[model samples]
Target: MRRLFRLLTIYAVFARYRLDELLPDHAASGIVKFFIRLHPAAWTASTQVHPWGRLRLALEQLGPVFIKFGQLLSTRHDLLPEEAIGDLANLQDNVPPFGEQAAFDIIEAELKGTTEALFGHLERTPLASASVAQVHAGSLKDGREIVVKVIRPGIETLVQRDLALLLTGARWLQKIVPETKRFHPVQVVTDYRHILLGELDLGQEAANGAQFRRNFADSPVLYVPEVHWNLSTNKVLTMERVYGVPVSDTQSMLAAGVSLEHLSELGVEIFFTQVFRDNFFHADMHPGNVMVSLKDPQNPQYLSLDCAIVGSLSKQERFLLARQLMALLDKDYEQIAILMVEAGWVPQSTRIHEFQNALRTVLEPVLERPLNEIEFGPILIRLFQTARRFEMQALPQFMLLEKTLIHVEGLGRQLYPELDIWEIGRPLLEQWLRDQIGPGAIMQTIKRNGPALIEQIPHIPKLAWDALQEMRKLSENQQKLLQQVEQGHLKQLRRDRIITLLGLIGLGAGLSWGFNPHWSLSWSEIPLGAWVISALGASLILTRLRSNPDD
Candidate 1:
């Protein structure tokens, strides 16, 4: 019943927004339009707002899952129009906080204690509230300042319910509209489900924070706060409180003498280092989750928070990504197309020349712009879009990476409009590529695997001997099989020759009986014995000639 109500609410919102009008002109759209017209609200739906604005508003009204979907869609420049992307980018998780008593109750329930007993002092007011959780300022008994995050009451059930509806809609869309398969609506919803569920688990977020903190332990450009595991649970997380100017507050940063240029460049460097060197990145790098430390004004450092969604690449993906970046920097469209096909991003049968031309058409103009004017994130989106035309498969990891890049690049460009991401990223990628394939890399590979290789040396002779014995046995068996086949062939030949000779004799007897002068052409004039002999001879000759020697 609850699910049915939710579904109805979604439809109501859809009708209220006149979302059917947003559908492209296709057979599926006609079916959708027919149904939408049946809803009374669709006739009176407001048309004052633009379609994109209505879309954003409708998603916000549909609740957190849809809002999160809008947030994700905002980064998909390849899939959505610029206006829609802009509108969706404005979608925020600014949900009203649950009551303070409820928050305290959840903390107590998850931690197995009273809130008062657990903390030095827990604030009744929330420091911040988002779709999944709310934060409250507090401290430990030892007076160490901290912030407590409590999962919203019953958000898991709500998330699951909404995700189910989204998945259903995605499947229906795919089934009804064949062209929607390229958009991978089902996969998008499925990936979103995992991301949303992961965010609900504070323990996972805590572990992510710890790993990120460890990755940048000695770094001057980035800082990650320590997780207080003793007080952390799957539904409750406590971490050391951090205070700094929000990265988005350019006025405050500038007042503190922070060099926006240096800060923006550092952001790019940190992004590349995390992706190439650590192989782990903070996927959610929105401004609300980032801050700037004022202690070092000239050399700004980034304070990262909310490590719920992190991304990493496999070794091969990392290598290919690096090569692709290098190819992009060198304006080698053919190499870029080749690498994409080799990486299995596109089908093996994809025409390289056509793909190259498509890539050039999209990228050449963007690359021709000044370094400061180029944006890697949008370039990647365009590249993926071109690849999609050639039937590129969905890559979840790459999607996360692309989203992160969008966040990082957007943040950088906001800080300094003249930020040259190409200038900052080119050297990092070049160095990483060299490290992977240079002479030193070969030595390192040998050094890492030498012991394992040496351990298997003593059994080499035994393995080789066993392989040779197996091959010899196979050869002998094959020779015996060939001999049997040859013998069968010889027997068949002899039998066929005997049958041929018998057939010839029978045929000769039939001819002599039919041409004899004593017998007239009429059947009545021939003797019964002669007739029987002639028939028997003809039957024998026909049977012998028709027989198959092999059978």
Candidate 2:
């Protein structure tokens, strides 16, 4: 019943926005059109809001999840209409805060103390509020400025409720619309479920921030705020407050003497570095989660926030992805197809030539376009679509990385429209690839794992003995299974011989009756049973022979 209410609410929002116009006239049935026409909001929608603008407004009104969905769609500038993407880009996450008292109560509960007891100063008002958490300014007893992030009260229940609705809708679409299978709506929702749930755990976010800080320690490109572990819990997180110009405020950055051209290049460099060099990245890098430091105006630095949804790829994936990108740079569609099959992204049975041609058809046009006119986000999306034809399963991490890259590249292009991402990123990726196969990387890997390797050396003999025992046990099990199979085959052969003998007897009796009609077993007296037995035996022998054609 609650789900029904939510569904109706969603429909009402759509009707209110007159979003049906976004769909084609042939998309809906006459009954749905009639009902839509009868709806009051359909006619009464505010005139000020344009047809495309209503999409963003309706999502905003629906709730945070919907707003975030719009934000995600906003990244796909190539796939979606420019006007729609423009409207969605304006979907701010300035959700109303839960009361100060609720925020304080959550902090107290998580920290096992009152807010006054825990901090020298705790603000009653929140500094900023978002979909999942709210931030409050405070000072520690040691005079350190910090911000307290508290998870919204009962957000888990809301997330679960909405996720159920989303999954239901996805399943409904898949059932009603067969073409939707290519989109993998259910898997997308499941990936989203992990991300949303992960955000609810403030401790994980704190850890991610700490790791990011460590990764960029003594570096000049990016800065991650220090996480105050003593004051943090799964529900409450405390970190050093950072102040800087938001990355989106281009005017402020420019006025502050920050080089937009260099800044744009740095954004691409940072993304590739995080993906290939560090192997860990802040996945949700919308402008809201990033800031620019004016202190280094000549060489500006990025301040990252909201590290809850970080992403990483396996060692092999990192290598393959880099190689694939390099292949794209070289316009080697054959290599791309081969790498895809080797990586198990596509079926091993996929025709290499056909796959290469399909990719070439999709990618050649974009590649032929001018460098500055190209968009990487939409190209990757189109590649995924093309891969769907060969039954390639989409990787969740790859998709996240794509979205983050899109955010970074899109923002970079916005900051400097002439930002050539391919031009900037190609050299960095090549350097990283060289590093991977270099001696320095091998030595570094050994040094990093030295302690663990030494510890395992002591157990080598025992480990080897145990492995041998396990293999012996597996061999015994296999031998027993083979014996059982052989016994069954022997039993079948014996039955076949019996059937053949019975068939010969029946055939001989039938022949005698046919040749000597006056005999006791006369042709007229011979029952249907004799003929059936003869046919059954002959069929068994023929089937057995066919099964073993070599015989």
Point to the candidate with the largest lDDT: 1
Clashing pairs in 1: none
Report the error of model 1 at residue 35, Å: 2.6
Local distance difference test scores for all models: 0.88, 0.84
lDDT of 1 by residue, 45-96 (tens): 8889998999999999988889998997787755776788789989967989
What are the per-residue Cα lDDT tens digits for candidate 2 across 91-202? 9778889998889888998899988889989899999999889999999998999999999998888778888888887787677666667557787777777878888899
Quote each prediction's TM-score.
Answer: 0.88, 0.78
